[model samples]
Target chain A: MIGVELRLMLRRRRVWLCWVLLCAIPALVAVLLAVTNLAPAPGQGGAFLSAVTSDGQLFPAAALALVLPVFLPITVALVSGDAVAGEASTGMLRYLLVRPVGRLRLLTAKLVSVGAFVLLAVVFVTITSYIVGVLLFGFGADAAVGGAGGITSLSGVVLTPLQLAGRTAATVGYLALCMLAIGAIGLFFSTLTDSPLAAALGVLAFVVVSAILLPLDAAAGIRFYLPTTHWLAWIDLFRDPILWRAVREGVFVQLGYIVVAFGAAWANFATKDVTS
Target chain B: MAGQRFSRRWLLVAAGAAAIVGVSAVQLPAAALDVDAEALRRCIRAEVPPYVGYAEASGRLGLPEIPQLESVTTLLTTTTRIRSYVAGADRWRADQLTGALGDSERDTYHLGAAEYVWDFGGNQLTRVLGQAPLRLPRAGDLLPPDLARRMLGLAPGDPVTAIPARRIAGRDAAGIRLVPTDPDTTVGRVDIWADPTTALPLRVEIAARTGPTLLVSELLEVTDGPPDPAVLRPVVPPGAGAVTASAADLSGALRDLRAPPAPARLAGRARLTLPSTPGSDLPGVGVYGTGLAGFVLIPTGRDVADRAVDGATAAGGTAIPVPFGRAARIGTPLLSVAVRSTGRRGSLLIGTVAADVLQQALLELPARGRPS
Candidate 1:
């Protein structure tokens, strides 16, 4: 059942379009920077943006920062929101349910497919950004001489190319987990209505409200539980000692969201009346 | 069958609600523990523990920005978040976290005799060579333990009494209040809370006699053990720009400008000799008094002084009469500054003393080219 869901997702034109648009943004940014030779002053632009001009190897991290704020979440919401509601709107859900597939198994398959899309999107962005970064920035000055030149951590400690690769891989994994939590919430919304747009809008509103409340002092009491509060925790992975405090909290928060949202989705779908 | 399914759905909702309540319940205040106030005070002064912690400090003094003092003004009027790892008095590292989301960081590592400063935003590492007798303030100075210890050391004669204990950073902390009896001092009271067992200060609050609280620094989370040694050692990255700088360079700039010498006595207070250290005996700078009531006198160029006075006046400073020139005074709840211009040179007097004290000191400053 999960294989069928994956195959269907792979063949969709909408899914392919999302991947292309996501990959195009970082490539466009690299062209602009290479042509103009102007990088924002240090600490002025996105996280690793200023450093990207000096060593393009850092562009993957900058690319993630550029998209994490809005682009990535929006795509996740759209794909996951349409998981069940899209099938229901086209009158495919009733026929599938009549087949001997249990509601729980069907919901599980839909969730697995959403999770796959998230991983695919994150991996594609990381790989494409790396190619664009090195082609424009090169391996920096020391790499040419076979010296110790590599990516510099936020703490001013040098990271070898291998270590930089490990950290970048870790960043991709952390972000994939964050997006999975959002997908779980979107799946829950997908079970609420037959309209895919309504389900997607519901998930987006949840994210927007969380983002708005995260910065308010009065909302501090509830900030810890907000899913959006720890979105930037992956930045800590690039630190020299790798400050794990925020990253650990972020992992726990995202896990909690996944468990609760998935549980709610299962409960609602099992008893949900599908008259259509 | 349908009824059983409905119960299952309700069960999931109940479990989610329970999880949130349980998390919030863990953060509720713990009951305070009884402790001897005097014993805790003595323990804090005598026993220093090695620990690692995260702290937050905020000041509401609203100090105006001035040239060459922008850092000082910001430290006194804004919030600072610091992560500190301490093994001893000389071996420690403080990382000041900034930016809207606390993503940017500047770290200072103090080894036995060497100091290194790393800027994450600029990707630069600086090794400080020497110490400056009079240095500007930094984020590390606002750490709860450091700030509490310094304030206690400065006013040793002040009376100390017990205040109600409170919970801080998940610890049952005992509190002490220090009230300065000196009429000339502007500080009203200082409240410090510490762990009774280790006497490590967890929180410090300072306020003026007649105004609102001025500064509050507290440890948000802490652990009671020395951090890994490798964490305190800063390695300069290969591609990072590394440079060596002298601490005295800032003060040396002032001395090269050749301002007038400071008076030996101002407002009946004799000039206090600074501790004799390398590069500290800069001529023409005077430190007055020996306690929290004391102030420093620096002779500066007329333009710098004028700019400071104008900044202060625009921030609600008041004009004051002085010998042979003009003077203006500005004050927060706990700090006072007076700038006086005499001929082509001027003097700046600043301290945690009363505004009138600065006014009297400014009146006694001699005109340039005149004998004291």
Candidate 2:
């Protein structure tokens, strides 16, 4: 059932378009940097952007930072928000339920499909941006002279290509977990309404509210549980000794969201009426 | 079937509610610890065991920004979050987490006598060489343990009393209060809480005489054990920009400047010779008095003194008439700074004393090119 759901999601042109657009942004950014021969000053613009000019190998991290704040979460919300509500709006949910598919199984399949979309989106962006970064800037001139072909960690420690790849993989996994939490919220909202756009907007509104409160000193009391609070914790993975405090907190928070949101989604969808 | 589904849904909601309650229950205050104030103070002064923790220091002194001293002013006024690892006095690391989004961080690694500063934003590694006789404050100075120890050291003769023990960072921390009797000091009292067992300070709060608490540093979470040795040693990455800088570089006002000798006594307080690596004394610098009631006299370039006087005056500093060129005094609840500009050079008098005390000290300062 999960495979069928994944295949069906892959068949959607909207999913492909989202991936292409996500990949295209980093490519355009790389081209502009290459042409202008300028990068944002350190401590400005995106996180790893300033370093990317010297070392193209670091561009994947720069690209992740570029899209993580808004673009990536939007696509995840769109896709996950449409998971169940799109079927109902198309008048397909009732028919699917009539074919002896249990509500639990159907919800599980939808969640897995959403999860796959998030992982694919992140992976595609990383891979495509790496290619674009290397094609435009090449494997840093310093790597040739120093004979240390690796990227510099945020703590000024040299991380070999192998270490860089490992850290990048870790970053992908961490980001996927974060996105899945958002997807779970989207699913919960999808179960609430039959209109796909309404569900999508609901998820977006939830995220927008969290993002707004995440930085306010007044909201510090409740900031810990905010969905967007730990989204940037993945950046800690690049620190030399790998400061695990935030990352550890982030994992717990993300897991809490996944469990609660998924549970809430299950609770609502299980007893939900299928009038559409 | 419908009833069973409804019960399961309620069960899920109940579970979520229980989880939140469980988390909050862990944070409930622990029982007060019974310990003597003097013992706790002694233990705090003694060598602490190796440990790791996350600390946050916040201040509301509302210090005005001075040219070339913006970073020092920011450290004294805003909230600073730090991840600190201490293996010994000389081996430790403090990573000052910066940026609202936690996107950038600066790490100071003190391995033995050497210090390396790593800036995550610029990806630059700097090796700080030599100890400056006088330097501006940095974020590391605000860590709970460091700040608590320094405060304790500065007020040895102050009366120490036991305050009620409180739970901090999930540990029952025995508390001590130091009340300064020196009238020259603006500090009203200082409160510190430390782990009853290890004596590692978990929180420190400093309050001025006439206002609310001006500074507070607390360890939000801590673990008592040696941190990984690798974390203390900074490895400069190849291709990353690396530079060596002297500690004097931190205080741009004190580099390559000379001044007239300071008076033996300022405002009726005897001048104190600052402890430094013998030959590294910056000559005209003088520290007057001792304990929590004293001020430092630093020679400054004329331009810097003029700019500082302008900045302080603009920030509500009062102009005080002096025999020299000009003088201005800015007083916060906990700190007072007086800038005196003589003919070709100037000197700054700053301390935790009152505005009048700084004014008197500025008056006693010798003029440029004159033997006191």
Winner by TM-score: 2
What stretches of model 1 exceed 4 Å from their correct place?
A: A141-149, B1-11, B28-34, B58-70, B73-79, B99-103, B163-172, B182-188, B207-216, B220-225, B250-273, B276-372
lDDT of 2 by residue, B1-372 (tens): 998978989697778957964674566666777889888888888766689988889888877776666777878888887888999888899988875456677899898779889886766788988787777677888988898888899887777998988889887888999999888888899999998889999999999997789899999889999998878878666556688887766556555446666678889888876667744556677788778887887787788788989989999999989866888999999999999887888788888898898898887777663647
TM-score for all predictions?
Answer: 0.83, 0.86
True contacts kept of each: 0.43, 0.46
Best by DockQ: 2
Model 2 misses residue A211 by how many Å? 2.4
Tens-place lDDT per residue, model 1, B84-117, is 9999889999988755545567999999888989
Q: What fraction of the real A-B contacts shows up in model 2? A: 0.46
Q: Residue-wise lDDT of candidate 2 within A190-256, one digit each (tens)?
A: 9988988888899889999998997676787888888788888888887776777777877888878
